[model samples]
Target: MTSTEAPLRYTAFTSDPEGGNPAGVVLDASGLDDAAMRAIAAGLGYSETAFVTRRDEAARRFRVRYFSPLAEVAFCGHATIALSVALAERLGAGDLLLDTSVGEIPVATGRDGSGAVVATLTSVPAHSRPAGRDELAATLSALRWRAADLDPALPPHVAFGGNDHLVLAAASRERLADLAYDFDALAAVMREHGWTTVNLVWRESPERFHARNPFPVGGVVEDPATGAAAAALGGYLRALGLVVRPTTIAIRQGEDMGRPSDLLLDVSPADDRVRVTGRAVPIAQAGA
Candidate 1:
């Protein structure tokens, strides 16, 4: 295999190699250009892959880029977690500052209760806006969902946390589970709106939620786990005053996909940046 093809593979948001969102990590991608990175990510067939273009060991800072199979992604949360754990295993756990397309993201890595390395990423300033009626109608049409399927409490909104995500809350867990959508239609709508993903979620309780993301814009039908979307959800709740106080939410995703990924989100009424934490495990060559 060529140097560009030999990226380290890891699955984020889960400790098991077989679960979570798998991402390709190129530790030293300084030599690779945009085309090379895109090609690598395309061949790997992951939702997104992370490339560390430049690293400053002294300051623990790096310039990173993310690419999906079809295009460059502005930011990717799962890939960030995957890369952070990979770095910690080799360089030792610590704080890392990543300069991304959107803005700088701060990540902290340390051992969890299970003695497994977990990474928490503080997203860039997050905000949300109500989705226009026309836009919401178009998106719902693409997803084959009707107005009745939506949760009245959580209105449709376009949220930003490094990238733009359309947050749609389902009225029931059953509605969230039955995901059948037009890929081409959804891709066209997402591209037109410059949306990174459609965050479809069902709130099980005050602090727990189940989610699924349709990433047609990335050439992926569905993402097992999406950290960017999770962060966006937090921002959406805060912006709408849904979160009255500081809260930590547990997001269960990828269960329907059989990947079973978990994401922890911390959000506060006063804080604009949301914190997402998850564990990652390396995927062996044979498994990859």
Candidate 2:
């Protein structure tokens, strides 16, 4: 039944298709089962594919799931943003309630300063815990970074917004840019720890940061723009007293990979949920 359906492709966190993380979107996946959904995600071969099972036009509510090329993800930030913008373009900008495996996420879609449709997703909740010495040591060994390379101020933390991400702050931008990891070793540690991605960041200023995410658990070596990781980092910073609440953070990612992406995050004092905003654009069809 799903054989006739072709997923729409979009790249999120950038205004241009060539600059952001690409995603596969199946707007109507009512007839698809888990097997069919997995197959579609495998075929699309993006970091993640989103399937929408239920859509209420009047209420702008949806039931969604995220599947990577290898496995199903609990939550996917870029895909949510992409799907939100896609829905807005068709139904007009407004708010949407997306029900995922993790929890219900409320997203608001609107026009940015550039007039491009952008989506902001409020995460489920944010939490942070100390990164144990053993975990940090193993991760550093896999990443080939010594203790001297870590930022003394930032420390180490395992942060969660929707999914868990290990946050490591590099002492310098140069150290952050040189990312070469033992894939198998890193993957093993990530699997053991149930980590989605390792959020490696370098602070440019109080408000600006540069980040790279190694998503070994998802079968992706790196993620260009990681909204979940960004949110997690925001929470981590707040937990560590690096920043105050009710603040906005700007993260620049994917520059080293040639696909530049921007993620804007808002952390408020009222709640633990973090808001991540970005624009998504449809990719031009190959033969069109």
Q: What's the true lDDT of residue 278 in model 2? A: 96
lDDT of 1 by residue, 165-259 (tens): 99999999999999999999999999999999999999999899999999999999999999999999999989999888999999999999899
- Model 1, residue 21: distance off in Å is 0.5
Minimum summed lDDT over a 10-residue window in model 2 is located at 1-10
Local error of candidate 2 at residue 112 (angstroms): 2.7
Error of 1 at 182 (Å): 0.4
For model 2, residues 1-288, the per-residue Cα lDDT tens digits are 143568989999999889989998999998888888899898888899889988788888999999998999989999999999999999899999999999999999999787799899999889899999999999999999999999998989999988999999999999999999999899999999999999999999999999999987788899999988998987887787766658899999999999999999998766688999999999987796
Clashing pairs in 1: none
Q: List the residue pairs that clash in candidate 2.
A: none
